[model samples]
Target: MKNVEIGALILRVVLGVTFFIHGLVKFQGGIENTVGWFASIGLPGGLAYAVAIVELVGGLALIIGLGSRVISALLAVLMLGATLKVKLAMGFLGNGQGAGYELDVALLAMAVFIIINGSKLLAVDQRFGKRQKSVAESV
Candidate 1:
């Protein structure tokens, strides 16, 4: 494959995996706790469970490349929240303790790219989408 395609694929997989793990964390923490955390973060209380569910299910959907456009868009928004809510204080240089906004920014970019370009090559979206067009022509 060409460099750009390879880069896009790698980015998608990495973002998918990273987001999935984060979602898993939330699941392990329990929806009530996650919702309380969201409230602490100033987000609306009603959105807590929805956000948690989205993270868990959406992260898996992203990993399988299912409904990639929608998943990427949602993930992009989530990452944007991270950049705005927490990362802004620490600055782009990170917390200086090896934890930084760099990962958040990268995830946002990857999700945005996937939203625009989609999951190309072989992806679950192909079969899951059930397009009349051939997989290569779906896009």
Candidate 2:
């Protein structure tokens, strides 16, 4: 694979695992707590469930390179929301009260890159695209 493809794969897998672990942690640590936290932050508590599901499913999709662009787009939105809503006040490096938005911004950039360039190396999406193209040609 080309260097860019390899870079994309690395970013994809890292982002996927990060999101998957975060989602899993939310559930494992009692999603009710997450819901409460969201409500405390002035967001609808029900949104936690949606966020968790999206992170879990989108992470897995990204890791497997299925609908990578779409998944990355969703993840990008999540990162943006997190940075804007939760971490912006904490600042980029934070004030020692809580972690900053640096990580979120990095993740957002990675997701945006994937959305624009796609993750095709060793990806299911690549195979699926090839199959579709072949089928269309046969027709």
Candidate 3:
């Protein structure tokens, strides 16, 4: 496939950083607060931690291109949950619950785009992927 170098890079970096910031917000309220918040919303405490780690670590992974597709896919699902759990009641219109999930939807779409496109040139994923493919083909 022909490489779209700029588009691939843009999707990875932008979505990665944005997802990372969402995780960073968790640190602001502390784990105790996060757990409490989750419990308040009827989610398990452990699940809350998992969500936090996934957003933080997954975003970092995407940034380094270590597991871009996996990370992107999971984050897309996470955003899906964010919408359903919290934003659904708010509807598409802006509300006190928070701004509508237009931004979250955008991020989900961007991550999905990265998944289908692969990490592309200049990505560590591409480098390792090539090596693995050669081994598989030889075998």
Candidate 4:
């Protein structure tokens, strides 16, 4: 693969694994705590479930390279919500009363990069695109 493709693949894998672990941890730790935290941050408690599910599913999608652009967009929005509602006041450091949004911002930036790059190389999207191109050519 080209260096660019390798970079994209690496980024996608890292992001996928990271979010998957985080979602799994949240689930294991009980959504109640997530909900409580959300409520404390002035967000609806029920949103915790949605966020958790999205992260889990989106992370898997990222790993498999399916619908990566869409998933990345969704993750970006999720990170935005987190940054705005929970981490803006804590500054850049995550060592305090509340963790800062630094990681969230980084994740958001990565997601945006994936969205802009559109899942190139080793991605299911590329396979589908190839098939579509061949069919179109035949027609």
TM-score per candidate, chains pooled: 0.80, 0.97, 0.86, 0.90
What tens-digit string does per-residue lDDT give for candidate 2 at 27-104?
Answer: 999999999999999999999999999898888988999999999999899999999999999999998999999999
Q: Write the per-residue lDDT of candidate 3 for residues 30-130, one digit (tens) a residue.
A: 87788898889998878878988898888888787878888999998998998898877777765865788788788888988988987765678778888
Number of clashing pairs per prediction, in order: 0, 0, 0, 0
Model 2 steric clash pairs: none
Q: Model 4 — which ten-residue stretch has the worst lDDT? A: 89-98
Q: Provide the overall lDDT of each model, using Cα atoms, as 2-decimal numbers.
A: 0.77, 0.93, 0.83, 0.87
Model 1 misplacement above 4 A: 95-99, 128-131, 134-139
Backbone clashes counted, model 4: 0
Candidate 1 lDDT, tens digit per residue, 1-139? 6777666677777777887778788778776787787789798767866666667788777777777789889888888887888677887887675456888888888889888888765678777556656665856
TM-score: model 3 vs. ground truth: 0.86
Ranking by TM-score: 2, 4, 3, 1
Weakest 10 consecutive residues, lDDT, candidate 1? 127-136
In model 1, what lDDT does residue 27 have? 71
RMSD of each: 3.8, 0.8, 2.4, 1.5
- Which residue ranges in model 3 land beyond 4 Å of their true spot? 1-3, 133-139
Evaluated with TM-score, which candidate comes out highest?
2
TM-score of 2: 0.97
Worst 10 residues of 2 by lDDT: 53-62
Could you give candidate 4's per-residue lDDT for residues 5-105 as a string of tens digits?
88889889889888888888889999899999889878899999988988898899899998988999989999998787667878878657868888998
